[model samples]
Target: MVNCKNCGTNITSKFCPDCGQPAALKRIDAHYITHEIEHVLHFERGIFYTIKELITAPGQNVKNYISDNRSRLVKPIIFIIVTSLLYSLVAHFFHTEEKYIKSVDARTIENQFVITSKIFQWLQNHYGYANIIMGLFIAFWAKLFFRKYNYNFFEILILLCFIMGMSMLMYGFFAIIEGMTHTNLLMYATALNFLY
Candidate 1:
């Protein structure tokens, strides 16, 4: 028997009994890289599966994830980050500019609220993190309103993450349509997102 590299446990089989680390670790190579990618994007139990579940039956899927089976769904935090990043990339690719902010004198804005402007710019650039911050605020309000429910604040945040992630996907899909058609559909997208 070999010692487990991860936890120094004696291994008698393919994995470590104590730590579950593989008996033999694969060297980093092209095959390893390909396998890792497949592991993450695999259709059966990866992001695609999670997206399908979220889209088809959001309420029941989330309920199952929170209560019964966590493995079937992608982790809530990762789901939000991946979806938000996807939306950001698609928006950038489509050259979609922020609609509200138009032709403000940088000097005056910076001089008035340097920190606030910086924070806003950062949030605009990094949507994944920005969405998480937004989710925290949303989760707080949801928790307050649904105090009768048994779920805690963190659980509510998980629900928000799944929901916000799906919303980001919706936005990304709309961004694609807008880019292809070369027509401004921001209002329609926003309305549909709210309805969703």
Candidate 2:
């Protein structure tokens, strides 16, 4: 047993002199390493369920999350972190190279890409003003249709994230499906929506 010099507490382990400061472990044991890996795996499983619930029922999931039993759900920031990383990864891989787009259909896709990219660029450049714009849009829509709920624009922003997160997840799923089916379902639908 070693007495912690700072706190004057006696501990058998090397960790605390007396105050329980972690003492370096002597054994770099395989069992300890395996236990740590299993713990991480188990923690990640809970995160997966949280994401699943959030995407499946955005409004309800968020409402419940912010409710009394809050810790049961993953934090909103964590959700955003995970979704943002996945979205960036998917965009990097799935998006076609700009130079390769030459066909009529490719041109159409390129145009849609240009429009969406410009809007995102504008939003990035003016986030504060853009938030106000988006906030007002949300507030107006909410007031028009959801008067009973009594949510404000800021609340709408949270809801929008939930929706967008779900959309990104769905987009990833559908992209995979499109790849497997060898059909341009996502592209055709996107074109129709823009054309209409």
Candidate 3:
């Protein structure tokens, strides 16, 4: 038996029972690189699986994630950030501008609060971070309304992350359609997102 390098625990199997480190770390070769890539993009329990579960049975999947088994679903925060980044990339590729924002005098807004304007601009550019901030507000209200339930604030936030991540994918799909058709479908997409 060899001692686990991670936690110095003696192991008799392929994985350490204490820290779950592999008995023998694989050398950094072509096979190792390919395996690492597959591990990250694994369809079984990775992002694709999470998306499929969320689309099929979101409520039950999230409940299981919070209560029964955590490994089946992707971590909530990573799921949201990945999906949000995907949406942002698709939107950028489609050259989709925020048509909802009307032209305002930049000088007037910048003069009032330069920091506030800068913050807004940053949020506009970074969809992942902006979505997390929005999820916090959503989670707050959800927790307040569902105070009778056993789920805590963080659990509710996790739910929101899964939900918002799916919504971002929906937005990305719509953006592709809009780009192909050369038609403004933002309103429809927003309405569908609200319905979701």
lDDT of 2 at 66: 48
- Please provide, for model 1 over 103-177, each residue's C-alpha lDDT reduced to its tens digit, 9 standing for 90 to 100: 333588657766667777787688889889999999999999999999999999999999999988998888889
Q: Give Cα-based local distance difference scores for all models.
A: 0.85, 0.54, 0.85
Residue by residue across 68-123, what tens digits does model 3's lDDT show? 99999888898899898888888888876464222343598757766666776776
Query: What is the C-alpha local distance difference test score of candidate 2?
Result: 0.54
TM-score of each: 0.89, 0.49, 0.85
TM-score of 3: 0.85
Error of 3 at 66 (Å): 1.5
Candidate 2 has what TM-score? 0.49
Q: Which residue ranges in model 3 land beyond 4 Å of their true spot? A: 28-33, 100-105, 108-110
**Candidate 1: lDDT of 112?**
74
lDDT (10s digit) by residue, model 2, range 96-174: 2121122233355757577666666565344334544565686578767886776665566555555544544554554
